[model samples]
Target: MNPTARQYDTVIVGGGPAGLTAALALTRYRHRTLVVESPEPPRNAASRGVHGLIGLEGATPDELRARAWEELGRYGLAERLDGRVEEITPLAEGGFDVATDHEDTIWARDVILATGVTDQYPDGVEGFAACWGRTVIHCPFCVGEENADRSWAWVADDPDHLGMTATAFRAWTGDAIAIAPPWLPGADELRRSLRERGSDLVLGEITRLHHTDGDLRAVELADGTVLERQTLLWPQPQRQVPLVERLAQDHALALNDGYVTVDEGRQTSIPGLYAAGDLTGKPWEQGVVPAVTAGSAAADAIHFATLT
Candidate 1:
């Protein structure tokens, strides 16, 4: 069921860390906030732990969200709605009419968009999906520590960060190998850096992942050769949520380098429309803490803006 409020001071979409924290901050200011969360599992649901968040390290994603919900419950000003947003139509007069899959409509003076991005993985690789978040990981700061000191491979579909990313992993696993196609940019320079940094380089695409119950054992190359690897870092690209794409393309909300452009206040180009969390910044800026910080900052801006 949805909240009965016909109008709200602020309506937060996506009940992740960013949206929840935004609501929490708005509630402290005595504003009636509505939090609309999708029933779908979070983007990080497959991961085992929520790393890089201070004091809450190693906690599961669900655990972190549960704690956030528990704290949000204490604030009577915020109402939680369990449903996915279907559309957001901005009224010409002002504010917005938010529609949900449950067929409920809520009007709000301000909208905070906290929908995050979706990671795109490589296709046509056997067992790749099963090994994700286990042996096949993304950010090293999040999952590499536990899998360190074993046979490791840093494979990149794109070689833009090959030199920096591959060389930086020496501390975690000194014998890690950097793998990329031979024809990518800076290939020769990457080879020199890897050699200087005490690492090897492999030039081929991964064809298959050898694993058992998500524990990766080997990575097969297109050349039909298999290399025993306990951990793999295949840095892939990510895309914005459908809502974000729609707003950018249809409504002309500005985008900075493929992400929603926000000023210092975290409000989007559209007045009274704000965006936060992983959906608003570069891939490198994405993390639990950044999302929470962005949400809180956006709430502060909205509170002051609403006052006048």
Candidate 2:
């Protein structure tokens, strides 16, 4: 190691549930770990509370993150750096050189990319962005109960995902209104299923979403008609983060259906590199347990590999 080198047994590229959990596990193993939390807010930043995560139910995103960081603080082997990663370079000997936007560079024997994913919002919908994570949510499991019992709009970018999202939202609301084009694949069957469940379907694109800060009011249709609603559930398409793109800038980063492909151990195609959390699969499938499991698994894998 260089005389002034900042080195770690492993460097984690996110501070959300996954990265934090991984850091906790690695530090508990007495390994030096550094967790880099991006300056950007988390995916559910606007949601008032987090659900489906036992013991931490109803905790807001800010609260959950704060608690996670505080817990990691109890372990002295972990360090937290708040900055955006700009570049990552593989070393000739081994390990990685990670550069951040803060003009800081660090080294690690291994890297875990819990970097997460970014949602691609619809372009022309009015107030959709503003209402997202507030009145408009991704999963019913995220903020279901409080936003339940009333009519809610469910938007699906792909028809294949329509049935799954529609069924999930039905647990909270009886009258499920799915905002999708009628021509998409599997539309008729999904529509039939909705009707069978005493729910309704809205076939077409969303023109606008009307909502307050934490309450939805209505949804406007392309035909100049509006439906009263208090919540809008959307499972939009998600893309990988910029760090993944930068890693693939010169060469192809192996992706399976636009997600970073990892083995059972959570290591990516590249050796000494790994990815967990929503970056490895559907972003909406994220919660505390899954994040913790994936993160801890990666930490254990790195530890066992190091032992040999």
Candidate 3:
């Protein structure tokens, strides 16, 4: 039982940065669009400000969204729904029908999956759970400046993550160390670079996190060795398959590395379907600009598709 409603030119899934950006473009292109978003906001604890972003640099996540909403409203081109999209089915005429967790359905000429991915942290670190997005994080560009020159540690349960995390951390601070099993990739390069940069690498498995006065203090290892550090960049395997799989199987869309496959114009495997943002497998540090650019590209493709 899908709830039927008025048909639209495009119905976007997940109204985060990408979806909203797409809506803005659609409006400018004179295409009707709607954005579906989850009520819960993105987790951003250690985030002082979104980095590498133009115009909106130093703006909090919520602030950026608010400004985007205002811009979208000015064009009367988009609307946001605080509900979950449960399903999407292809219609016969190069269009898609979407079903939501709420009792509602929407028909559209195109669909864009701007739904983001989830980052899963390592298990069994006591205070680590609470420190996520705050003192513990993954992307250095997103949280590096605030902890510069302070005590920092890189923890990874998986041994293979050392090289990549080490490289990303080096760009942020010269004083960083890796705490994980000894089986590190590019060990020679990492050790040489770390020593040259005055960083240390400790071999052990982190067992728990310690905090003082609600501030992250240090990480405790299995051998009961406590490394005193105010900030930690921990790496964990990321699982990003929910919405992309739904779109791929149900609508015959292409997927690349857990991201919806799209062409130069942002068209997906399914002709009219498009994707952008984290789900599109672009660099995660891309805050608003990339999302907006992808959305505009998709809008142009949609317009061309309708004309032909």
Candidate 4:
């Protein structure tokens, strides 16, 4: 260990909603906490604003983060360090040593892994960059109600997913279109359900998207067929960040479907090591509100565990 390594009660990796929330709770409890955030933009950086969070509805991601940092500063128990965690080594002495890109080492009695996931968007799709988060959304509930009654399209990797997603989009609008790529699986039941829901199906591979100023106008197919749509629901897959993976592998933390496995209190399999937020492998808990709740819960658990 470095002779000058800073020590804290807890060291949290990642500064997204989960990490910041945990830091806030820890600080409020007067626990010495250190938050290490990467210089890179968060996964939700492309989104214009966050949804599903009351009192902060429509708040941009940047705004939410800025406000969170300000709140965390009030307690003076938590400090933010701008750097990426390169490695986390569990010390035999019962804490952990965290190494960062800034060449600084931090030792903490407990480590909280709040590193979020990364979204994988489709490649070679025109206008995707501009329309993403604005018109090209993933979860219908996230941006669906905001763009309700508009022409909506659901893009999925398979016929079953397309049918299911399109059917769900019907809650927001009646004019839902399922973009069924040519490679989609042939499922009569799914096709029937789509038709039963009055959702139109476009059978072709999307080659490009036509949009203006982040507002989607239409998607062009490989056959040059253009289907007009105002909003698109394309659920992108998510993967854990490198730091989470490294910690899981190095510490032998349990994982389920690539997400960290945590007990009800957000504690990982390893004692003194905890996890929170999206990395917890719960699909229904991927939103901002849930992330905040998970962080607070993890802090509470850690506090209680330390007392014993």
Q: For each candidate, what TM-score against the reference?
A: 0.92, 0.90, 0.85, 0.93
Scored against the true structure, residue 138 in model 3 reaches a CA lDDT of 68
Candidate 2 lDDT, 75-181, residue by residue in tens? 78988888887777777788888888777768889999998889899889988888887778776776678787888767765656566544666668776667777
| lDDT of all predictions | 0.84, 0.80, 0.72, 0.83
Give candidate 3's root-mean-square deviation (CA, Å). 3.2
Which 10 consecutive residues of model 1 have the lowest summed lDDT?
157-166
Candidate with better lDDT, 1 vs 4: 1
Top model by lDDT, which number? 1
Steric collisions counted per model = 0, 0, 3, 0
* Top of the candidates by TM-score: 4
lDDT of 1 by residue, 1-308 (tens): 13573788899998888998899999998889999988888887878887777888999888987888888778788888998887787778888888888887788989999989888888899998888887888777767787888888888745656666556776688668878875778778777877887776778878899999989899899999899899988756788888888888778889888888998889898888999999887766887889999999999999999778
Write the residue-wise lDDT of candidate 4 on 1-308 in tens digits. 55688989999988888898899989888999999988998877887788878788999989998999989878888888988889888877788888889888688989999888887778888888888878888766677777888898887767656756555766788788788767667745666777876776767777899988988898998899988889988777888888777777777888888888889889888888888888885544587878889999999999888788
Q: Which stretches of candidate 2 lie over 4 Å from their true place?
A: 1-4, 157-170, 182-197
- Model 4 spans with C-alpha error above 4 angstroms: 1-3, 187-189, 282-284
TM-score result, candidate 1: 0.92
Ranking by TM-score: 4, 1, 2, 3
